[model samples]
Target: MPPQQALAIARAFLPKRPWGNRYDYYYTRAKLRTDPLYPGVLAALRDTPGPVLDLGCGLGLLAHALHVDGQPRAYYGVDIDASKIERARQIARRTGLKDARFEVVDLGARWPEHTGNVAILDMLQYLPSQVQAGMLAHVSRMLAPGNKLVIRSALGDDSGRGRTSKVTDLMAHFAGWMQEVPKSYPTRESLEGHLANAGLSATFSPLYGNTPFNNWLIVAERRAG
Candidate 1:
């Protein structure tokens, strides 16, 4: 999405009161302009069918992006932050986005019952390795043949970009954007192994566009038996 287009979307997030709305507006603008996460996820989900269950969806940006891009898929976004969820709901309602919903749910504790494509973006590192593994397994089960499970995360490594991602996440925690400090970052090998164990194949690609983070987009698919 271009900066001018992103500016238009950020307008939807602007709150009624100017007190805290500026933060959301600027954050959404910066994220949409600088991060390539939304476009990448949209491309991965383009040909897929059925509703989308977006785990760890913050402020439901993906839903908004999907609506803007004319995907027309039902978007159910869940996150642990109630405030963010509420704001997402309000935006969706105000924008008259059809079939878009948001809910506050602790992803580490439970997942909503869903059967379709799944997306876990930029939130896996906050969960422990075991929790992340379990979540992957559950997502794998939910995915029907030919459906996708898309994930965007910073793969763990010793490179400068990897270190930068770690530090950035920590700063987000300290800055109150994230309530939990990142516990573990998954490596490419580990994520591939987990998907394979669940009878899925994954393709990983760099998603860092004009950014210094080590983010990668992993698109996993369940083949027909």
Candidate 2:
């Protein structure tokens, strides 16, 4: 199915807010339509035959898209934002997407116990440097052979595109949308090193789409010993 159709179906699961909080709906549509990350995520999970544990999942948008696309993998999404979790739960309840679950979770304190495909999308930058490594370590241990961990994050480069992403993140933080200010972004090499330390092989790709953000997707898979 084309991404547009999948996105349309996903939006159908969300409540209509033509007047109140309309920005969320508009943002959702624009994101699902323009951001390459959503399609990239679906492709990453296509062959991974297990439940998806999404860390820092915002509004469980990916879960909705998966459900719309008829992917049968059960989904468990965790985020630190209570409001987003509530919104996700409401969508699930309204749409009757029983396979999807969302919860308010502090990833720094405790990681959920699950094994399968994992996703950390546009979220790692919000974590402190130490917590980011620890979280990566925990996720690595959770995966067995054939399990993949997909991460989409902006790269830290001293370039114009890098600055663009950084500025956007800062604005988001200032607007109170992001709970914590982004402390740092990892270089591709550094991220790969982290994946290697976790016993995973990484495949990196530019996922900026038509945007100027220095975003990349790292699909790290644990191989059989």
Candidate 3:
């Protein structure tokens, strides 16, 4: 689906009042406009099978986007924020998403029981390095042969974009948007190694949106032994 059309459908799912909840509405709209990751995510899931597991799914934006794009697959979104999960549920009801489910679960506690293509976007960096590695390992185990795992993160690079991303992340931290900002961001090498050790071959590509950030996506597919 075209980005504008998809975004229109997405906005339809937002709160009805134009002035009351302006922040959420405008934030969602702006994200759809500026963030190219949303479109990339849709493209990645186009051919993948159903029952998508979305980790760190804030306000269930991806779930709503998929529904708007006419993907009728069953979606399960897990996030640590209770309020976000509640809003996600409300959106699902308001939009009549019968196949979608949202829940508040601490990712560090354990992996939710699921089997399908996985999407971890813009959330892994909040975890410590060890936790990140452990989650990746668990995802590797949960992924059956031939399934895909799509991960988007700001890799630690020395380039201008990388530095910009770091500063923005710090601002996010100070704003209380992100609670657990790690001391270090994952480098491309370390991220690739983690995936490789999990027996998943990953290809990297830059995901530059209208914003200046060093966002990159890793599309990893599990190979049959």
Which candidate tops TM-score? 1
| Tens-place lDDT digits, model 2, residues 96-128 | 788889888988688888878899999988777
lDDT of 3 by residue, 21-83 (tens): 656666777777768887888888888776789999987888878876777888899988898
Q: Cα lDDT of all candidates, in order?
A: 0.89, 0.83, 0.81
lDDT at 39, model 3: 83
Clashing residue pair totals per candidate (backbone < 3 A): 0, 0, 0
Instruction: Name the TM-score of candidate 1.
Output: 0.96
Candidate 3 at residue 72, lDDT?
Answer: 82
Residues 55-169, model 1: lDDT tens digits: 9999999888887777898889999989889988998898888699888998789878889999999999978888888888888888976789999999999999999999999
Q: Where in model 1 is the C-alpha error above 4 Å?
A: 18-20
Name the lDDT value of residue 162 in candidate 3: 89
Q: Highest lDDT among the candidates is held by which one?
A: 1
Which residue pairs in candidate 2 have backbone atoms (N, alpha carbon, C) closer than 3 angstroms, thus clashing? Answer: none
TM-score of each: 0.96, 0.92, 0.92
